[model samples]
Every structure is written in C-alpha cells, then in structure tokens.
Target: MKVTEAAAQLGVSPRRVRALIADGRIRAHRVGVGWEIDGLAPSKERRALSVRSWLMLGRAVRSRALVGLSGHDRMRTAERIRRLRESDRPSRLLADWRPADAPAELYLDSLTARADRADDDYIRAALQRGPEYLRSRFDLAEVVASERAIRGESREELAERASVSARLVKNIESSQPLTSPGEVRRVLRALDIEPTALPDMVLS
Candidate 1:
C-alpha cells in the first residue's frame, strides 16, 4: 500500500509512515512516483499500534469528548481503561501520544480536568497510578530463565533466545529481579508459560 494509505490503515498520520520507512523499520519502494509500503516489521507495528490506541484513548478522555461518546468511541474508551489497568502497561505511551503540534502540558491539563469530574474514583486512581504498580510485581530475568529451564533449552541457546548475554542469563537464574510484571508477562508469552503455573512463587 502507498505510504499514506498504510498510515491511514494504521490509524496514524502519513508522516509517521514516512518516518518508519526512513528509519528502515518498514520496507517501502517507490512506485509511480509515490512511496509504497510493501512490508512491515510485525513487532514494531504491533508496538506502534498498541501505543497509538492507548494514546488515542487518552486523548479522547482528556478532551472531555466522552460525554457524548457513542459506539466506537465508547468501545475505544473501555479498551484503553482495560489496557491501562493491565500490569506493566507501558504507561509512558500515554505521555508519548500527545501530538507534537499540541503541547503535552495541554493534554495532561485536560486529562486532569476531565479526571476531576469523573464519577469513578477507582478508574481515576488507576489512571493516576499508571503502570508502575505492575512493573514492581514480576522480574523479567527470572521469568525468562525459568521459561528456558523448563523448556530444556541449553543455557547458551536460551541466552540467544532471550536476547541477553550468557553471563546475564546465568546471573538471572540465581539473583534476577522481578521488578516489572510486564517483563515477566512478556517472557511467559514468549514461552507460553504463566504465573499460576508457579504457584509457590506468588507474591504474598
């Protein structure tokens, strides 16, 4: 698809598509004097899509635009709330989504104003706490190590799989910090493991 079309499909502006192409994250080719995005970096695309969706939801809520929200808007808002409540939410995406053309302070100010009027204190507090609570719950290193060990993966092979140095993997097995639940979740996702599978280690 052409750059503009691809960006539109991704729900991002055309400039973002060009930037990704320029950064070599997305492959493109010139076709009839226009740039066409022929392929995408799946991981990057997923990340971008996720961030974009979160930002969109934040933007809508901050704008106080939900008072009259309907169908898609309501669904989008609910999704954002769910994701924000998720552990290791990459909460930074909220701040990162503010448009450059618009001051971030403005967006935040708007969010604060809207939040103040919200009827649900639980939702507001969750938003205020952000994703830090989730990060503190799980250790990425230990999760990765556990997954590798359980899979009968060789230490060297596991290190490569986890994209970490052998030394790091070795240390993680003994003293890894589960500082971020999100990291643990990603490791589990990679290995199709789950926290419930290790009931003995659940935080008290």
Candidate 2:
C-alpha cells in the first residue's frame, strides 16, 4: 500500500508515515514500486521523535545548560540551532518517484535543489538510485545542451531547426524545467536524441 493508505490507517499524515520510515522507527519492506506498509498496523503507536521535535529538544537543552558557556560560545550555539530550525522547514523534492526506503545517507547528502540547497551533483548522483526511487533528476535540458554543443550548433541554430524561439531553448537550458511532453520530444528529435532512450531506473 501507499504511504497515504498507511497514514490513514494510523491516523497520521503521509509525511509522518514517511518520517517514520526514514528514521527507521517502523519496519517497511520494499516491494516493486511501493512498500508492504504493514508496519503502520493499528497495534503500533507511532510517537517517534521527528526532526522538528529533535530540534525543540536541543533548544530546551541549550537553554537549560546555558550557565557554563561563555557569551561568544552561547551566541554561536544559539545561532546554529536557529539556523538549523529554519533550514528544517518543510521540503519538497522535485522528482517523479521517491522511495519510502531511500538510504538516509544518500537522501541527506544528495537530494538537493530541494529545500534551499542547489546541489546539482547530488541530483546527478541520485540517478543511480534503487528501484524504489525511480526519479532520475536527469535533466533533458542538460542532454539537449550537451548534444547541441557536440554537434557545433548554437541555441539559435537548434531553435531554427526545431521551429521554436531561441528564448525557449535558453529556458530549456536553464532552471525552469520543461513540462510539455510534446515539446520535449520535439527537442530530442532536433538534437538527434531518442526520447525513448530514457534511463531504466524504475523501481524493481
């Protein structure tokens, strides 16, 4: 079942269910594209300490133990805690598929352009992820740009051939991701790239 179903059974949000999975508070088995979410059984009480709660505890501990620290150290510690709390704001991953059992190491180190980090390398590394994580973070724009360069063609040249504006080509190369499937296919054809040649990293 999906995280939503498991959350429903456990009277929590899908986010909470994912949190439990990420923190290893619940036992979930990977099954193809989904998980066998039996861990959210009614008998379990999922009161795991979330990241936010952990930060809260840190703040409490800091406040209580402030007597021994120097003014400078106290300021630094307080600032660090504050920054961590701020950065811990809700994050949304821009990918087609994210697995419930993604490794904590990879998830934390990579998976950027998420939250406030612009970690393109992390995104690229994540392309080699397991079946449960199907999203490639693979940018078509990057491929198109690379191909155009190899063929010694400028954006304007490719645009003329593709019958689209150079500005559109530049947009495709930039951060604003291309969304139209038809446009994507057309661009691939212009670059002599096959749209069907996508990475086969789906959930096994």
Candidate 3:
C-alpha cells in the first residue's frame, strides 16, 4: 500500500504516517522512489496528558539533560515544544505521543517527579488557606479562558453568543472585574456553565 492509503487506513495525515515510520512504529519498504507500507499496525489507545503535564515536558526538553537525547529526537522534541507554546489550544496528540527511547523515558520520569513536588506544594498551600480565601481565589480568568479555548470560540464569537461586547469578554478574560453580575451570568450561560455554581470571585 502507498503512504496515502496507509494514512487513510490509520486515520492520520501523511506527515503523521511518515513520523510513525521514522519512529519505527510502522513497517514500510522502500520502493522505486517512495515507500510502501506493509500493513496497518494495531493502534494503541493513548490518553492525552493534562496541560500541566505538557508544560512539564516542555520544561524538561529545555533543561541541560536534552543533550542526552539523540540529535533527531532532540530536534523533533524542540520543534513540537515550540508549536505547543505558540498554539492557543495545542492538539491532544502532542501530549499523547512521545519517542519510545530510553532518553525519552528518563525525561518523562523527570517530568513526573516535578509534577509530584508541584502537587505537594499546591496541597500544602490549599491547606493553609481559609475557606473564604479559597473561595476568593476561584481564578475566574483561568476558567473563562480555558473554557473558551476548549469550545474553540474566539472572544468575538463568545461575546456574540453572550450578547455582550467583545471588549467586555476580553476584559473578563484578562481578570478585569465585570461590574454587572447579569453580564457575567450571561457569559457563563453562553458557555453552558452554571453561573450560580461558581464563586463570585472576579465578577462583581
């Protein structure tokens, strides 16, 4: 089968097929000019990691330990990290896929260790905060921005749906308090979120 045919069968782009071949995850043979895929391999069910996990992986790639990775793997990892940083909502595949190499395994382990320490610090901080302080730190900006990105809606589109000005949506997302509670509720309702459920942290 040709690369295009194999890609179709695998439900991935031609570029992704090539990447899989390079990673030795796919079997292919060189033909006259292009390569011919033997057959489709059994697909692995990989879950996407959290945004925090992706950030940790990016950090690991930037560390001095990156020199331990193969030149090819290092270049690919750096390119992917650049794309991930530039994208507003990076693809889930970026978090799911990684090189199956010893160096990559070590990097993953390092990310896990960093995450464990961060989680512990977060728990400790939360324990020290009073109920009122915790309520006030609901992080409305983060929630609104994340939800908007997940829905793939621009500020203009969200504002239109919420029947508010785009500037108002931007202000809310930038952590600027909205004076009108009704407007805030409308925005939350447009996002299919329960306004009453969230604490009145950033909204007036």
Give the TM-score ranking, best first. Answer: 3, 2, 1
Predicted model with the maximum lDDT = 3
Q: Taking the tens digit of each residue's C-alpha lDDT, what string does model 1 give over 63-164? A: 322333445655555444433333132233333343444434555555534444542343345343122122322243444443353344666776566555
Question: TM-score of every model?
Answer: 0.26, 0.29, 0.38
Arrange candidates by lDDT, highest first: which order? Answer: 3, 1, 2
Task: For residues 1-204, write the lDDT of model 2, one tens digit per residue.
Answer: 777776655544566667678877667878886666755433333232344433332332333222333345444433332222222122222221223343344344234234235343443333221212212324444555544543546789998898887886786666344455555556667865655443332232
Candidate 3's residue-wise lDDT over 163-196, tens digit each? 9999978877777645776777788778655543
Worst 10 residues of 2 by lDDT: 128-137
Better of 1 and 2 by TM-score: 2
Error of 2 at 63 (Å): 52
Superposed Cα deviation of residue 133, candidate 1 (Å): 27
Comparing 2 with 3 on TM-score, the higher-scoring candidate is 3
lDDT of each: 0.47, 0.47, 0.54
Is candidate 2 or 3 superior in lDDT? 3
Q: How many clashing residue pairs appear in each of the predictions shown?
A: 3, 1, 0
